[model samples]
Target: MTASLVLAGFGFGSVAAQEDATTPRATLRIVHGISGGPEVDVLLNGEVLAEAVPFGTVSEFMPVAPGDYVIQVVPTGQPAEAAIVQADLTVEGARSYIVVALGTPDAPEGRVYEVNLDEMTTGMARGRFINAAPDAGGLDLVVAGGEPLFGDVGYGDASDYIDLPPGTSSLDLRGDDDQVVSPIADVTIEESLAYEMVAVGQVADGSLTMLTLSTAVDPSCSAALGLGGAIEDACVRLTHVAPDSADVDVHVNDVVVAEGLTFATVTEFVMLPSGEAQIFSVTAAGSPIEEALITTDLGLDPGQAYEVLVTGDTEDLQLAITGIDLRPVPAGQARLGVIHASPDAGPVNIRLSDGTAVVEGLDFRGVSEYKAIDEGTYELQLSPAGDDQSVLLTSELQVTASIVYDIVVVGRPESQTLAIVVLTAPVPVQAEAIASPVASPGATPVDASGG
Candidate 1:
């Protein structure tokens, strides 16, 4: 064998031994000054040679082939754009190297501003602190670039001030219960601006709550009622019924119809035309319900349909008056058709209240076909719930004993608004039947002479 003493390179054959021996390895240490750590990765010839190491931690890898290699140090979970440091280093076989990872530059913390309200007058200027995030709590209020305005109070209840600034300004509200800060609310300060700070919790409450009572009638005949006629005047009664007393106000078309009605509960009234439709709104002090107007003037005609709606503050409470058709029936009785539309698709209770007793046993769902009701001076009301529930409609209807009449109740799509239409026949009829029922039933029938 000519004494061919094969010199195994590290127990490998000579050909492969030279290649394995020439391979070079590197070790890197990534460091960061911030609380979050940095990640480290080693590459050979632009190819990743090992798994990434945890940030702010040290990791070791096997020797890599000696050549120009790149070392990358990046923040964990961040892309290459977020790489804190990067370097290209040359490694020789059997040699060791160390790399130090650097951290990103620090960002400045935000400062707070102080609002003083010591000189503000109560009731003269109403003030309250609202967070940008409706659900967030505690926010810190302090003097910009200065110590906290309120000592020891930090950014909690004592930090915010209201009704002090002579003008309105954006304010940051910190929650006392948690580390939540409200987005800025444009607070108008008309009284004093440079006084002691007021806690958000101490602000006066001025929110409004609304209750609605609605009913529908034939638009053609009822349209005249909305114009304020004695024959078509209607009223909606909203009772607070809540244990706590409230200041109630009623509005129609943004006009204040009633205000400052203080009671444990309240009753509101709205007038609608006999063949017209409209929206009514009720507001109660210190409630979250917004003041809104219901729609009247539903474009209804004979043989057409419409709806009337009543909505509550709670999302779960909604009432719809649907399937209202206007037609001319005989005098003594009027044809009234209505459907209670609800998401639950359940039955709705109907009641005819004469302002004293309630007539029960009336329930409907979806589309209730047209039915004839005896005409008289009556208040027609509907409630989704059987007893003492919110009213969907409350209005007076006068039916002539001999003329034909049609009433249609229509519900608005995706809204708690309703439209009522009343249709009347042109046919001449007995004057006694058309006369107001309020006149004594046994009294002599008066002639048409301006009686």
Candidate 2:
């Protein structure tokens, strides 16, 4: 199957931000708060501090010498002379600060806020509010249905740190004459922790929003050590491979999880409740859930991910469920998996176009173990087991380092529609266990099925 590289779980890479406790330097964090802004690079004193930072991103705190410095924001990969916004700020030793790039891309603005990192009174949490919304003038942050917490905060300005009772509290942003501008709900304020809330976006277009940035309370900083990207909840993606089926909707527990999924297309991973039986159904687009063409009950485990393949013809749709491993592959290697989903193409063998056998006797509904292979391009050929005279499918696969490619053999040979569909995922820090048959050359095969 010929496939394009699909980038998943993309985010800014963390620059090394930890400094020795004895270092006489101030910590600085750059935040991308500009509405609809391009990916940018943050420069401190003419040097790049963070690279390729996208909107709504808050960087890890990096230590810098306490003194006056020039800050610049430029489009990522651009020259230093192309900075769209520039400002001068001074920071004190042993203190923390945040620089927010706000407003539109054409007319960017910056706001600086001094953060309180000092120890707080027991049972109380602290928060600093910054008004980054260029159009929301004179905002008052108040407890929802209660009193004001920070009053008359102007645009590009910050309010004094306010002590809040520990627990979840909702707040409202009020404008002139105490008119409610926006209601932010379910804010968690844990005791002994500090937070910064920045009001951003344009108020005239109803895009005014707040970003709550929290600081780690423990020195371990486990929450900051790339653990936030781990998959703690179970997720499943649905791929419509039934060649003759109409556009369909996937329903999980009577709720539509994916709508109008066309043939050979896959949906983004949908989060689902795990550790219990889930009722799954498929119906024609715009059809009621009761009119399901197929229904199945399955239980998924937490901390794992899955792919549900809908194969076969419209008259007899089949579901092939397979768990996928997302853990990172060994350095310089690529992971490969194969699934035999074509009902008409009975047990088949796979080999390189140059005559190197890779898999043998893989039957319908069979899924192969992910094999570690050297990253490169390969021409793959498949045919009936031990019969090289009849080549059923051949395609070129380009494998990149640290990527996982799962190829699904699909379509009906009788209708001359046989082909393959390739799905890919990036290497992640999380690992999951799954069972499937088939393997690369020299590896033992496992006895498993995807149906």
Candidate 3:
């Protein structure tokens, strides 16, 4: 018998399919949608449902006893007692569903969606669309040179189910006035299978893209995102901050990276290939090749993001490079970076109000890389070169999952007015690829980064 199982009380999830009363079992598939999260194992009532389900992996449908089941997702190989996302899942006999492990890893939110598969015949394929872009406005999607497949789709909205001829299809997304926003070509859809196509991330940052999910195996789907949305290399943005510096042109190994850039201008990140050292050069806006002003070398690692900010005065230039980790944090975890930016402060150590040292002997304008920790209100203290008892500055911060923060020393240690400046910025959307360049007042924002 055909039917749709609505999870009205259990998080309002919906499951649609046919029921086989004689079998007395429910069919289930799962999709791993938590970006940056580690592989996870799904369990029901202390029983393993699936193991080591990695990011971007999908699972097929399997039969299970129908009733109210205690559902949980934990790191692969961990004990069942340790769960990351837990919920109560109800499955009716012979029904089917797609349970998706989504949201940032630190604050996971799993979703249950029921799909109907009665039209799996004559080489036909079933599909639906979802909009997951964080800030994209209404969008129009169409087949290559064909009628609209999805029109005016808003953020977080899913479209009606559709039937299409199985195989690879070329598609493109458009904004207002039908202007092409992104191209999603060469997507393959197999016959006799159900699928969900999603457009997720921020469009302006070049991370807005697509993914095609299939519900056959226990939790199966395609790649993370396309339309060139996912950045697989080191990312960097340059900013020019010297107060007395002229409108300068920047270069990386003789190639003009950004030209005619004025002070206080922070350019959007320029995608860079990782695993190599880069030579950055600066010259007067209209200067000749041989008369460059300054140069610096920076090493960028793969699967990470970095920032190179030009600091100090126009005559004595400096480059401050810091790495930004966009990897998913475990559930309930947060990340922080401490920077020593007090121009006149001597080498100082960072610590907590309770006398725990976090950074040691950091010199003027130095920085501590980002580190993960449990979310909480941290009372920070700056001491004289690791001497926690000699607290110089203090600040309290409340951190949350998937959020990054920069705790900066803003005044001279010897100055009675010394204090800590806590700057907070949003995590890079799904791409999570960005860096922050900290600049004090009387300075500008010209770093190969932002904020």
Most TM-score-accurate candidate: 2
Q: Residue by residue across 1-451, what tens digits does model 3's lDDT show?
A: 1111223212233333322211234556666656566898988889888888986666655566557777888889987667777877777653456676655556565667665535243346677776655456777778878888878876556677777676788998776678777789898876545677766545666656676766431111001111121233455656665545788887776777677887556554554544456777888898865788888777776434455556555557776777654432333444677766555668888765555556788887688866654556777777788466767767777777545556666544454646665544334211111112222222111223211
Against the hidden reference, what TM-scores do the models get?
0.23, 0.45, 0.40
Better of 1 and 3 by TM-score: 3
Query: What local lDDT score does residue 311 receive in model 1, on the 0 to 100 scale?
Result: 33
lDDT of each: 0.33, 0.69, 0.60
TM-score result, candidate 1: 0.23
State which candidate has the highest lDDT. Answer: 2
Q: Which stretches of candidate 2 lie over 4 Å from their true place?
A: 1-232, 429-451
Worst 10 residues of 2 by lDDT: 429-438
Which tens-of-lDDT digit does each residue in 1-451 have in candidate 2?
1111111111212223323221234556788878778899988888999999988778876656556667888899987678877766565554556678887776677766665655455456778788888778899988899988899988777777877777888999999789998899998876545688888877787888788876532111111122222233455778998878999998877777789999888876655656567778899999998899989987776545578988776787878888776543333455678888887889988777767665678988888876655567888898998798799888998878646678888887888888878887655211111101111222111111111
Q: What is the lDDT of residue 66 in candidate 3?
A: 55
Mind sharing the TM-score for model 2? 0.45
User: What is the lDDT ranking, best to worst?
Assistant: 2, 3, 1
lDDT digits (tens) for residues 186-294 of candidate 1: 4343321122222322112211111110111122222211222232233232322111224655444444544655532223223332234333454554332264323
The true-versus-predicted C-alpha distance at residue 198 of model 1, in Å, is 83
